[model samples]
Target: MKDVYLFSGFLGSGKTSMLTDVIRQLKEKNLKPAVMMNELGKLPFDSQVVEKDIPLKEMLEGCICCSGAEKTEAQIQSLLLDSNFDVLIIETTGAAHPVEALDAVYSPLFADQLNVKGIVTVVDTKLWLHRQTLTPQVRSLFMEQIRHAHLLLANKMDLLTEAEQGQAVYELQGLNPHAFILQTTNGRVPLNLLEDLKATAQVAKKEIIKAPLSAMQLGSCLVEFTGKEFTQEQFEEWVRTLPDTVYRMKGYVPIEGIKNPMLFQYAYGMVQWLPEYLKMPAKLVMIGENIDTVPVIGFN
Candidate 1:
């Protein structure tokens, strides 16, 4: 069976950066790979970073594990019929839970045409270590993303010490004992890790790993923002004022007089800013404990 690889990771887990490296490896080997990316927000930024040569398709504004699942199934079918690519690489939204996302591909329609290559979930080791203090629902959602992975890419290894890295590996191993764990820096991993041959054994054993229904139903709200162009100063102030319960905030915003979209991210009490060029809408999505306390700001 031809293999279809699903890449699952949490927000800011470096999926795009890692995929860039993987694409280069595939090219070097003359491996024909097609891509299907799921972006949770309407404004898709990572697609631009991907190399233009590869055949790429996208599902936006929804997680492929949920609302986008049917669309994903149809797209994959379309890609298969339309192209002769050797392997299909699907990079799912950080919010995508493997348990749910797998449902999209396990249909009888593609069973013969496609083989489950294995779900490779990426973990930001730095954040993994400190995320225990988050609310139970958030914690469960994070754990749910990794529960059925055939491989776990322990990313951001450079941020940890030797002992901490070991601990991260151990933690991931414990999270999904069936998974093969590998340490990765900046999302780069050995090419063999992405190969169909390497994952066959694990994929054969993968069945659904379900989380509690209650926890599965609860998660951070997907907030939509519009009608405001803020000054740089105002934007900074607003992010700083977000609720303590908010652990992650990311997306792009338009600032007055700035030619490029202002990339924004907030995590672990710190915020980062970057000027990114994308004509997409300015939308901010935050995943955390309590989103109700998040406030909207107007610079006018």
Candidate 2:
């Protein structure tokens, strides 16, 4: 599976700078990497920063979390099919929400082929300190981005005084106690820091003491079995073990010994498998709260 890393931060927070450095380091290690850049501007200004050889997809004029989400899915599928890269780096617009950006990446077909490394958020320490001056909605969005990060980079530290730097660390730690925070100038983060980081979309139970179910939003991911088939017994067993949070699943599955794919659906603990006269895309969309964590459909 290819590894995926998400770059998220507010405007002028140095996400592009961080992405450049990450690409450089990956090249140093001789690993191939691809990039998907989301820009709200008419043209993707950041695309110029990525080298020509790297497989690049640009999403312009919209945030990946909202208007651009459908496009994001198509672009990712294209990259997966056309490129031969070990890592995929997605840079979202400064205004994008981390959760929605991730939602866009978890398409059922792509989820199994990609290993989500985590969201790395860059913080402009100065702006963070003066965040109270911003409008409430923007401020909340920034907070949400930071809160969901597995790795946090407090960038542009050169502008902060020693005392202010200390305060930024303290307050950021308070906001996201689970993240591994690092202070850097110009977003120069060490690759070693990312060695073992993994993102579990599920929020920790202890952290839920104050904000319960905030991470359990209703979401969906499509599962495609175009080039694969599954045994009916194993497939049913997989469905039976799924959590109650999985409210519904519907798709076509190519069952062993069956001439064509079957139309399958599940809801409220009930399962339905109907015979289909023709072969359709062996894909199903699963919907529920926190469904992004659902394991990829297996074909053993």
Candidate 3:
């Protein structure tokens, strides 16, 4: 069985920085690890930050809590089938709820093969204090991630005053009494903390089984198709016919007449294109609200 560790946090909360460090530590211990990164935009910012040798799988344009969950599970399964990794690290989008993402992994398909190691919530102490006043949705998402974490990492501690840091820790303790809390700058916590921390052995499986499907429907819908190749004109025509419910779409597409594969990203009907020199297998993930994947079968 492989340990699945979830690294979740708000925007710019240092989740990526922490993840890079964690991957380095895992490699030093001779553990084969795979990474799954969920991003809000088409840009693979975090992916570029990781070491080139590490295996990385990405789900973009949709929060993990939404249409991307199933795809995430599928990717994990594929990685497990193809490689002999000892652990899987999932770095979720800033807006995602950690619990919902965790719920997605507890599917019957993965129940016997994967174990929940611990949920690590990285917090920007300075930003978290003012988050409540910005927007209700942001606050809800932040709280959800923090509340579900088995270990809370107070990152960017240098940005906060000593008293502010203390206050934040106290508040976090109140929210989750069982979580182990630590403060660090740029997510510099000891590697031992990650290796030694474990999930509660007696967690009720029913809790995961009972989470409503609606809770998982918190983000846009998405469908991803991968194959050896796809035509650019064919992909463009398919995008033009996308439903109104579809708000965001992105992924790598292979087409003729382009030296490198083309990258397409759409948000609220606006689309952008990027030409990349390097190419990989043709894979695309589309994101939208209430998107019906059945209607887009031709693209697959």
**Candidate 1 segments exceeding 4 Å error:** 196-300
Q: Would you list the clashing residue pairs of candidate 2?
A: 108-222
RMSD of each: 15.8, 8.1, 11.8
What TM-score does candidate 3 get on C-alpha atoms? 0.66
TM-score of each: 0.64, 0.72, 0.66
**Which candidate achieves the best TM-score against the true structure?**
2
Residue 50 C-alpha lDDT in model 2: 96
Residues 157-222 of candidate 3 have per-residue lDDT tens digits of: 788888998898999888867678998888866778876655522122222111111211212222
Per-residue lDDT of model 2, residues 1-300, tens digit only: 788888999999999999999899999999999999999889778899999999999998888887676799899999988899989999999999887787667664455576666789999999999999999999999998898787899998899999999999999999987788999988988887765665533222111111122342444555556466778888999888888867666667889899988988676698999998986656665655566666664531
Clashing pairs in 1: none
Q: How many clashes does each candidate structure show, in the order listed? A: 0, 1, 0
lDDT of 1 by residue, 1-300 (tens): 566787888889988888888888887888888898888778768888777777888888877766676688688888888877877888888777775676555433344466556677888889899988768887787887776566778999999999999998988887777667888888887888667333321111112111121212212333333455778787777767776756555666777888756777666588888887765446554544323334543422
